[model samples]
Target: MTKKTVPVKPHRRSTPSPTPRPNPNKPKPGPKTVPVKPHRRKPPK
Candidate 1:
């Protein structure tokens, strides 16, 4: 009765770094105006 065997090592993953882009002559945000109410619907008999 004799059994001994342990050797397992294989795991290396590190490659993903490239993200930096946000700056293009900042100034673009203007379009939001809604004011007009007129709704009346009720006739069914």
Candidate 2:
């Protein structure tokens, strides 16, 4: 279910792509960043 979920997640995630991305990453590094690193460089499952 977890594996199947990651892709399904991006569906709802599609609309709020930029919304939630920075919301969480905001504290991680601030919204001043390029906003590509966290998504691309993240190693979490």
**Using lDDT as the measure, which candidate wins?**
1
State, as a TM-score between 0 and 1, how close model 1 is to the true structure: 0.14
Worst lDDT 10-window in candidate 1:
32-41
Cα lDDT computed for each candidate against the true fold: 0.57, 0.56
Model 2 lDDT per residue over 1-44, tens place: 35454443444444534445645545575577765676578686
| lDDT of model number 1 | 0.57
- Clash-forming residue pairs, model 1: none
Candidate 2: residue 19 Cα off by (Å): 19
